[model samples]
Target: MSDNLARQFLLREDVVFLNHGSFGACPRPVFEAYQGWQLELEREPVEFLGRRLHDLLRAPREALAAELGCGSEDIVGVLNATTGLNIVARSLDLKPGDQILTTDHEYSALEKTWAYVCRKTGAEIVVVKVPMPLTSEAAFTDAIIAGMTERTRVLFLSHITSPTALLFPIENAIAEARRRGIWSVIDGAHTPGHIKLDLEGIGADFYSGNCHKWMMTPKGSAFLHARPEVQGLLDPLVISHGWTAESKAPGAKGAFGNSPFIDEIEIQGTRDPAPWLTVPAAIQFRKDNDWWGVAAHCHALAQDTARQLGELTGLAPLSSPEFCAPQMVAMPIPECDPLVVHTTLFERYGIEIPVFRWQDRCIARLSVQGYNSRPQMDRLIDALSELLELGAPQIAAQG
Candidate 1:
C-alpha cells in the first residue's frame, strides 16, 4: 500500500529518503498545479497579478483557514515559517529589559532572529531547558510557566520542535501566557498536515507554519496567523503598495480591500505566488488519499524504527511516544561526529537522513511519510548498524 503511494511522489528512485521533516516531498499532482499557476502568471502577467490575484489568492487562504479552523482574514501567506516568524519578532514594541521566553528546542534560524531583535531592542532572551525524556504534559507546561517573569513580554514555543521532533503540549502554556497578558508565538513549522490543528482552540496570538514541510506544497509556501485583536500591532517587513494610512486606524480596511493583516504581510512586490496558490491542491490531495490513515501508519513505522535504532546504539530516545511528533522521531545515537555519520549514511548506504548534534546529544532524526515503506526503514536500520558498528557483539560489549 505504501509502495503504491510512493509512486506518486517525485523523489529519487535510488535514495531512501527519511528526511521529509526537513522539507516535504510534493506529489506530482500538486507540483503540476504549482507549475500551472506559474504558467498562468507568465502568459498574462498584468491580468493575473493585477486584476485576478486578490481573488485567486483568497481561495487558497480560505481553504487553508478551513483546515486550520480559523478565519481566512486572520492568516496571510508568506514564503516560509521563518519569514512569518521574523515579521512577528521584529514587529513587537519590545523595550530594554523585556524578555522573550522560549525553549532550548527551537529552530536555529528563529533563535538567530530573536537574537537579532534582542540586540537591537536590548530585550533579553530567556531559554527554558525542557526536561529530557519528556514524559508528562504537566512537567512540560510547568517548566514553561515557571520560566515566565514580570519582565517576560513574549512566550515563543515550537508546536513540533525542529531538532528534537517532539510535539510540545503547549495548549496549557499558551493559555497561561494569555492569562498573564504575554504575547504567544508558536513556530508550527512541522504541524500543518502532520497533525490535526485548531488554531482558534489553541488560542495563540501569533502562529506560523509551513505548507511545504507537511502539507506537501512547493518549497516557498507558508503562513502566519494572528488573532484579530493583535492584528493591528504588526508592521509589514516589506512596506509595499499595500500600505495605507487608513490601515493604521481602527476598523479601517487595507489598500487591497482585505484586512490590514492580510494586505500588509502578503502583498509584497513581484514574487512567485505559485507555491502559495498550490496549497489547495495539496489539501485536496490529502483528502482524496485518506492521508490521516497514512499518517498513522507512518507514525508507527517511525517510532518502531526509532526503537530499533535505540536498541542498536544502546541510547535513549528524546521523548516518550505520545510526546513525539506523529511522523518524525529524533533518535539518540552514541557519541560520534554527526557530519561523518550523515555523510556515510548518504554516500555508502543511499539513505538520506539528518544526523545532527543538538546541544549535548547527537541525534539522527527520521521523518516517515506516506511514500516511505517498511523496507526503506529496514534499510535505514541496517545502514545505521553498520555505520555505528553496532551489532550483537557491540551490545554484549556495552553490557
Candidate 2:
C-alpha cells in the first residue's frame, strides 16, 4: 500500500512485534528528530525551555489542533493519556453519591483514576457491562445510555479500549449526555495516529490520547484536549508556576487568564519538553508518507492475522471484520492461563505479543504497523499451529 520512505519504522530485530497498539514503534526519521530536539534541550537548558519552549510546544499543538479539528486553546500537551485523564479526574468536583458511569471494557489505569476519585469524593463507579461478541455501534451506545441514572455525574469511556481494542461510538453518547447534563470524559489512548480523530465531532467534555502509541512519536509524547466550557472545571494534577495568573510566568497560560482548568493541569514540574515538542515533526513524517494508505494496509494484515489465529486455535473472534477494529484485534484462545500463554509466546518463541485475561475470556491482541509484513504474521501462525497441532502442553513438559 503505502511504500513511501516515511513508512520506514525502526523496530528491534530478533522478535516478531505484533503489539504496536500497546506502545507504538517510532519511525527512524521521527526517532532522529526526537533525539535532535533532546540534544538541543541539553545544549541550552535555559534558552530552550525558558525562552523558546512555550512557542515551540504551541506550534505542534496548533498543527495538531487543525488535524483534530479543534482550537489550540482546547488542547494541552500532557505526558501520556493516563496523565491527561488524571488531570480531568482530579479536577472534577465530585460530591458524595455522585456516579461515574462506564463500561467494563475500559483501560485499567484509567479505571483506577476514576476509582481513586470516587474513593475521595464518595462517588460511585457504575460499571455497565457491554455484552461480548459485540456486533454493532448501536449496541454499544445503547448499553451505555441504558446505564445512565439520576446519580450519574460523569461518563468515562475509551475511544479505543486497551484490553479489547474496540472503538466505541461516542458521538451519540456525548450528545445524549449533554442533553441530560452529564459529563463525558473519553480516554482516547489508542486513537491518535491510528484512526481519524475529530475532537469537535465527539462532543466530549474532556478527551485525552497518546501520540506515542499510534502516532509513532517518542515515549512520553501525548496530549489532553478539553472543550472550552468544560475546561474551566479542570485543575491540573500538578501545580507549578502556572498556579497564579496575576503574575504571568514563562510557563503561564497566557492571554487566557485565570483559567483554573488549564492553569491547574498544564504545568507539571519541569522535565524534558523535547518529546512533546517533537509532535509536529512526527505529524509531518506521517503526512509525507501517505499515512492513510499505510493504515489500510495494516488493517488488512490485522484481519488476516486474526483469521489465521482463529483457524488455528478454533477460538471465536471477539468481533468480525466489519465490527473488528482496523489497527488491532482481540481474539480468544483455548482455556489457558494468560500469563502462561504469554510466557510461552515470548520466552519460548520470541513472539512479542499481548495475551491478557479479561473476565472469563483469554484475549490475544494483535497490532499491525507498517513495518509488519505477512511473513511476520506467518511466523505467528506457524508458532501457534505448532503449539496446537504438535501438542504444545506435552512439548512444554519436556522443556
Candidate 3:
C-alpha cells in the first residue's frame, strides 16, 4: 500500500523524503487539478480574474471551512500560514507596554513577524518555556495560561509546534485567553490534515493554517480565520479594492459582497489562485484514498522508527506519544553539529530530513506520510547508526 501510494506523489525517486512536515508533497491528481486552474486563468485572464474570481474563490473556502468546522465567511485563503499570521499580527492595535505571550517552540518565521510588529508597535514578546519530555496535557495548558498577565494582549501558539513536532493542548489556554480579553492567535501550520481540527470549537479570536503542509495542496495555499465579532478589528495587509469605506462601517457588507473578513484579505491583488483552488481536490483525494487509515499506518511506522532511534541514541523523545504529532516525531540525538548530521544524511545516504539545534538539544525531525515505508525507515536507521556510531539497539522501548 505504501509503495503504491509513493507512485502517486511527485517526489524524486532517488531521495528518501522524510520531511513532509516542512512543505508537503502534493499528489499527482491534486497537482494536475492545480495546473488545470492555472491553465484556465491564463487562457482567459480577464474573465477569470475580473468577472469570475470572487465566485470562483468561494468554493475552495467553503470546502476548507467544512473540513475545519468553521463558517465559510470566517476563513479566507492566503499564501501560507506565515502570511495569514502576519495579517493578524500587523492588524492588531497593540500598544506600548503590551506583551504577546508565546511558547519557545513556535516557528522561527512567526517569531520574527512578532518581533517586527513589536519594533513598530512597541509591544513586547513574552516567551514561556514548555517543560521538556512533556507528558501531561494539564501541565502544558497551565504553563501557557500562567504566562499571561495584565499586559498580555495576545496568546500566540502553534497547534503543532514546528521544531519539536509536539501537538499542544491549546484549547483550554485559548478559552482562558478569551476570558481575560487576550486575543488568541493559533498558528496551525502543521495542523489541518495532520490532525482533526474544529476551529469553531477551539474558539480562537484568530487562527491560521497551511493546506500545503498536511492537506497535500500545492505550495502557497493557506488560510486565516477570524471570528465574526472580531472581524472588524483586522485591517488587510494590503489596502486593495476590497477595502471600501463601507467595509469599515459596522455591519456593512464587503465591497465584493462577501464578509469584510474574506473580501479584504483574500482579494488582495493579482496573484495565482490555482493552489488555493486545488484545496477541494486535495480534500477529495484524502477521502477517496482512505487517508485516515493511511494516517494510522503512517503514525505506527513513525512511532516505531522513533522508538528505534531513541534506543540507538540513548536519548529520550521530546514528548510522550499522546502529546507528539501523529505522523511527525522530533527524535532527540546525541550532542553533535546539526549541520554535519543533516548534510551527511542527505549527501551520503540520499535521505532528506531536517536536523537542527533547538536550544540545548540536537533533533532529527522525522515526518511520515502515506508514501513512506519500512525500508526507508530502515535506511534512515542504518544511516544514523553509521553517522552517530551507535552499533546496535540498546534496548527496544515502547511509548
Worst 10 residues of 1 by lDDT: 390-399
TM-score of each: 0.97, 0.93, 0.97
Residue 217 error, candidate 3, Å = 0.5
lDDT of 1: 0.93
Q: In candidate 2, where is summed lDDT lowest over 10 consecutive residues?
A: 247-256
Q: Candidate 1 has what TM-score?
A: 0.97
Residue 279 lDDT (model 2): 87
Candidate 3, overall lDDT? 0.92
For each candidate, the alpha-carbon lDDT, in order, equals 0.93, 0.81, 0.92
Kindly indicate the candidate among 2 and 3 with the higher TM-score.
Answer: 3
Write the residue-wise lDDT of candidate 1 on 228-335 in tens digits. 999999999999977898887989888889988898888889889999999999999999999999999999999999998888889988888999999999999877
Where does candidate 1 stray beyond 4 Å?
A: 390-399
Considering summed lDDT, which 10 consecutive residues are worst modelled in model 3?
Answer: 390-399
67: Cα error in model 3, Å = 0.6
